[model samples]
Target: MRTKNFVLILLSSLSVLTFLDRNAISIAGHRITEELHLSESQFGWILTAFTLSYGLLEIPMGLWGDRSGEKRIITRIVATWSLLTALTGLATGFVSLFATRFIFGAGEAGAYPNTAIAIRKWFPLQERAKAQAFVWMASRLGGALAPLLIVPLQMQFGWRVTFFVLGGVGLAWVLVWHRLYPSESPLQDNTDQQQYVAPENDAPRWTVHLKDRNFWFLLVMYYCYACGVFFFISWLPKYLQAGRMIAEKDLSYSAALPFLLAAGGCLLGGWLSDHLVSRIGLNWGRKLVPVVGLSLSALLMLGCVAVDSNVAAVIMLALGLATMDVTAPVSWAIAIELAGKASGAVTGAMNTAGLLGGTIASLGVGYLISWTGSYDVPLIILAIQLLIGAFFASQLKVSTPRALDKT
Candidate 1:
């Protein structure tokens, strides 16, 4: 394979590693809560701790990656998070676990922004959405695999040992990444000149993005999208086993199905976005896929709430998640399209908003369930949030250079 493609594959693997680490906690949620003697709300706070720190640290990490180089930043990220993931297994109570998860979130904060920067530096604009698709698909694959993998390990070795094992997997990836990933582009002077390697421009400041209206819209849209998606990653497993009373034997398969379905959604979203851009022009191409996808996602989520059978409900939830994910790559592409050279900073800002949404959703769902005695209310709220995201997506100005100024 070409070196650039090789780099893409490695970076994509990092994406998978990230989701595996992040989702592992949720996959082992039942065991953790039982061991710690924690209430549902307290467990929710544990998840929130991670997301809050992840959101708050995103911009700094993104800026650092942009200035210092993603290779070094990514190296630090993997090492820190891996160590923290191991420490997570050592937590004795709520405070210790929350602190560990918060720091772990900080460690993992800049991963995707750095990945976006790497994509911006390495791939052509036309191919970026598809590249992002592969990265997200890998993440979904990791998420899909997490329940299937973690549950069996937890059943065999206990949850603490299962976490220790997951931590080791990341450390191994770090060794390969440090050795193989080149900081500079391998295909710099090739025929892919359309892939603008954003020139260094110290003149225009990063604050320019703050004043851009479209940037805020993108941020809001991403925030809403993340709220809906976060519910699945942070709460789905427990929601299946607890809220819906799914059998433990069925929990792993049920939890994994949505993400597995979402893997296909990412590929479809990427292909559709690229195809539409070529045939109908960027205006409709970029906006249409997300608009349609998120809208359908909203409808499907509502279906999840309305269904009677646990099996039918899980299937609806899986379809809803897949539909929502169809917009994931497109959203990242919009960030890259709007930010240009500062893809890291802009995408980081957008992700910050998104994770903030995730933080809120994580905390809220716990209380929402505790208060209401069911998942129905929270699911309805998330469905409404997806609709709001679709509205923002429809308003995006992707075709014009007017969305961003040339630095």
Candidate 2:
């Protein structure tokens, strides 16, 4: 295989490992909650701990990736998170599990931003959305497979054992990543003394990103997007089992359904986004998909409440998730287009916004359940956020990164 394609595969594999470790908890939540004797609200806090730390640390770690290199930073990230994933299995109570998840989130913070850097470095501008789609599809694949894999494993061995096994998988990937991935460093060997400039020539001052109005627009848009989509990541399974009262034997398959459709959405969205960009133009091509997709997602989220059958509701919710995901590649592509050489930092900022949204959704779902004893209220709130996101998506304009323009 070609070198870049191989690297893409490795990056995709890393994305899989990352999602697998992250999603395992949700699938196994019933066992964990029962074993630990956690209330729904407390369980929400556990999920929030991961996302809260993940959001807060994304910029620093993404900046580090830009300055240092993905080779070093990714290795450390995988290793640290792997250790924490194992430690998660060892948690004897609420506080310990929450702490482990928080640290794990910190370690995993910059993963996608760094993946953006790798995509920018390896692929041409036109191909970025497709490459990003490929990477994100891997993420959905991991999420889709988690319930299918974890449920059976948890039944056989227990949630703790399942976590330990997942942790080992990450460590194995780190060893492979260290050996196979080429240098992402912009610096040349010291003996030759020739400078290896980053894509924008030199890295721009971080303040440039801070002051850009477009950056804030994209961040808020992403925040809205994250709030809606993360519902599946952290709480969907529990919602199905607890809220919808799905049978344990069938819960894994039903939970896997949304992520499976979402995986297809990423691929379709990526291909369509690239086609639109090539055929029409960036403004229409890049911006329109997200607006349309998010709007549909919003409608579907609301539709879920009207359905009476548990099976029908699950399908509607799955479609809602799938439609929302269709915009993901476009969002990431804009981050690259807007940031250029600072793709890592820019993507990081966007992801940080999204994770903060995730954090809120995580905690809010629990509180809403506690307050009203119904999942319908939380679903309605998320639907409104999706509509708000669609408006923000419409406002985004694709252009050269300010840093690149200055140079």
Model 1 lDDT per residue over 180-279, tens place: 9986883334444534533332224456878777788888889999999999999999999888988767788999999999999998998899999999
**What count of clashes does model 1 give?**
0
Error of 1 at 284 (Å): 1.6
**Poorly placed runs, candidate 2 (over 4 Å):** 184-206, 402-407
Name the candidate that leads on lDDT. 1
What's model 1's lDDT at 398? Answer: 72
For model 2, what is the error of residue 63's alpha carbon versus the real structure, in angstroms, after optimal superposition?
0.5
How much is the lDDT of residue 50 in candidate 1? 93
Best by TM-score: 1
Candidate 1, residue 275: CA error in Å? Answer: 0.7
Q: Write the per-residue lDDT of candidate 2 for residues 1-407, one digit (tens) a residue.
A: 27778989999999888888989888888899999999999999999999999999999999999899878899999999998998899999899999999999998889999889888777766788899899888888988999999999989998899889988989999999999998743222222323322234354665586777778888988999899878999998898998898988898889999999998888888889999988998777888888988899989988888888988898898899888998888899988888877888899999999999999999999999998999899999999999999898898777655434353
Q: What are the runs in model 1 whose C-alpha is more than 4 Å off?
A: 186-204, 399-407
